[model samples]
Target: MTTEDTSIEQNDDELFEHHAFTVDKGQAPLRIDKYLMNRIENATRNKIQTAAKGGSIYVNDTPVKQNYKVKPFDQIRVLFEHPPYEYLLTPENIPLDIVYEDDELLVLNKPAGMVVHPGHGNYSGTLINALVYHFENLPNNSSERPGLVHRIDKDTSGLLVVAKTEESMTHLSKQFFDKTSEREYIAIVWGNVTEDEGTIEGHIGRHPKNRLQNTVFEGDDIDKGKAAITHYKVIERLGYVTLVSCKLETGRTHQIRVHMKHIGHTLFNDERYGGDRILKGTTFSKYKQFVENCFRVLPRQALHAKTLGFKHPKTGKQLSFDSPVPDDMQQCIEKWRHYAKHQDAK
Candidate 1:
């Protein structure tokens, strides 16, 4: 048997685990689930059955039931919502801004500077830590992270939904994976976007030179990255900077920051993507000092996950939530507004 394993990262934080196998020509017929159990490490018959029930197991591109017999040379594929957790989670009694809650799921407004889940060097003070503490028996996404469905950057404040039950986790994850969920972000970026609105399309992947950053790949190198689409419209112009609303068609790590920068409008104060150094303003010392002050006020990247919408896992009702811009971003925007007004008056 030839086997191939793949793990794909989706929607910034969602991870999909994929496995493919080609049956040997001489292989005897066996139940697909049992066949997978023998080939995949640590896979249980129950887990394989669950994957089949979710229609995540395929035979020759067609979803198959657990009882289906694997014929000789048949192609088989399996998909899991997430991978195994890398860290042992410790529940912390951290405060959560619960926006809305029900028996099946809950929505919370995550503040900036908070990590979504425990990871290398950030094992504590994460949203997951807080979640496990506040709630009991929260369903683990395939990754073993309890309650988490999706995530934003550590510094991007926004609304996120957490599943309280296994059914909810499966349902909500399907919505996000199918691109039926809606997510919108508000950002303050350097430069006056020449167009009132536009769509940015490019493949996003890790930078070749900088391991910490993600960059856009175009032309012949497009295959090097994942396809990403961002639709942006100007909300307000602030002279050297602009406030914009970005709707994501596809979510990738640093999609907004990378796509905006690709168009010459790096997010204001985005230190990772080079927005912290006044990429758009004048060289005058006074102007330089003003930009520096704005940077200090915002402190992090000027991006926020402002809105989230999804279908209720059980009820099938469409639910949407919006978050107000945080105070630091508000204050920084005000400063730029004043600066823009002053420049126009001159």
Candidate 2:
């Protein structure tokens, strides 16, 4: 029997272009995902894994498993939907910590371990997913993400704002885009900063090769990365690490984490981009072993958006709110302080 086949010629609108391979290879069997990878080159295995979950991909003109065997007379076609991609991020019944709310906007003290939005590797249990399930109408104007103004990293806990209406979202988004909203954070870093207060200046862009991380480099064009500015001050000195307050002059992806690392003082739990080398010079080395070992108990990033202040996009009234660090962070700090004092006595 002759099998009919269809193929999609994908465009490179996204970072990488994909072309679908389909044929009437009768009576042979192969895993749907493996067959595509074998036929396609430079295609990431992870990307294939994501695409296989959807319905558009099929084997023998019928959808099958990523590991499904393709018959010899199978017709394979890839229907690549480019624009207006369907959102697979389903809403889960995750609890939200609300700090302040109004008709236009809401301020939530987003907890650690909660993903703010849906992206690769995460399809559920996200803030956006929850918002969708909760709000009857949150799609701002005509956006896929409803009521989202800004987002915090999955691990870093702090204040986040959500716009309940399109008009409000447009106004609030402008504030962040124009660098008018005031954002403040408190963090524990590995060592003492020389000046009580200072600024870290660097252009933050994606690590050209490493798709998962951001870096500080001087690039002539803005597309490489947006300008990121972090102003910080030392609040108190720990035995080895310093607890500091940070303010954002510009908001970029992972701005604080990247800037703190750039200044040689990565946040306490930010081992990914921050190294604890700040302990080299100071008396922290006295309890260096303990310093390293104690804070290590807290695995998540040691940063918090303690406070957020913004103007009402609709009411024209000033709105501000502050969030205290969760008990874990406080405990981490206290443990470090107590250990340092005990070592100093010895």
Candidate 3:
């Protein structure tokens, strides 16, 4: 059986997906776009050509144009900053940590490292695949993402709700759109936030240079981005890191991460936003080694989607759910507590 190699990579705030395929011996020469269309589900010619123009398409490990012909036994690869929409979704029996389930909707805690839905290089083993396999006739709002009202990042563990019917999907979506739903996140960020409570207001949009990241914009240019607001309160104080609870007013892509970074407290271990490095702390070798050990314990961003509240679509009753911080993050926090106490003694 032929196997395709796929990897998702991020570098210097740039996101890229890598896909490699080997052509069959009997394959005939064909335009690269056409060839990809036949091989990659839901890939349109325009999208393929755009990627080619962006230097994201490759053949035999070399960049190629959309018209580059594919020959028999040739190696084909493609790289893109974003995952294209997936056309086909196959259900898989992946276990889910379902928090609550009713006829109208179901709430579940999404673990870290599990994609909320399939896209780009992630075609399977997603929450959507598991939901489809476990339930019947979940609603899709004219999109591939079925029953989703909103989405959290794949690496951020959290609570999410999925609609079981169209009415529920519409109602829940409207609630999110109107900003009536309540969502709270627990995050550990570098640097001790000076304020006990504060609100972060910014116009958030894609970074001008890095397509993989979002940034805060202001003044006339602020009109180019969406308005985003995050209200945060200090939860705990570690020596070099502060734990904060963030509540969203307007949900934009990476809103919390961007807003926090704009305020000079990047989420701990959030490599995409430059938090993985030693942003705050002394340059001593022992301090550096301690930070490295903490990084090893928590490999992803120190954020958790801890609480969600919304009115039920069917019953008009309020519903809420909460999830504890996962083990990795908890352990990392404990280590920091010990280190901070040790430092205070010196």
Question: Candidate 3 lDDT, tens digit per residue, 132-188?
Answer: 899988899655578888999988999999999999999999999999999999999
Candidate 1 residue pairs in backbone clash: none
Between prediction 2 and prediction 3, the one with superior TM-score is 3
What C-alpha lDDT values do all the predictions have?
A: 0.86, 0.72, 0.85
lDDT of 2 by residue, 1-346 (tens): 1112223343443211123344443435656676666544334666676776765565654655567666655656555454211255566677788888777878888888888776545657888888878776874533357778888898888999999888888899888888889999998887667789999888888654343568888756456676778999998887667889999989888888888877778777675564533444346555566556655666687889998988898878878888888888888889878866775798
Error of 2 at 298 (Å): 1.6
Candidate 3 lowest-lDDT run of ten: 1-10
Candidate 1: stretches off by over 4 Å: 1-86
Query: Model 3 Cα displacement at 137 (Å)?
Result: 0.9
Ranking by lDDT: 1, 3, 2
Sliding window of 10 residues with minimal summed lDDT for model 1: 1-10
Q: What is the lDDT of candidate 3?
A: 0.85
Backbone collision count in every prediction?
Answer: 0, 11, 0
How does candidate 2 fare on TM-score?
0.73
Question: Which runs in model 3 stand beyond 4 Å of their true positions?
Answer: 1-85
Q: Write the number of the candidate with greater TM-score, choosing between 1 and 2.
A: 1
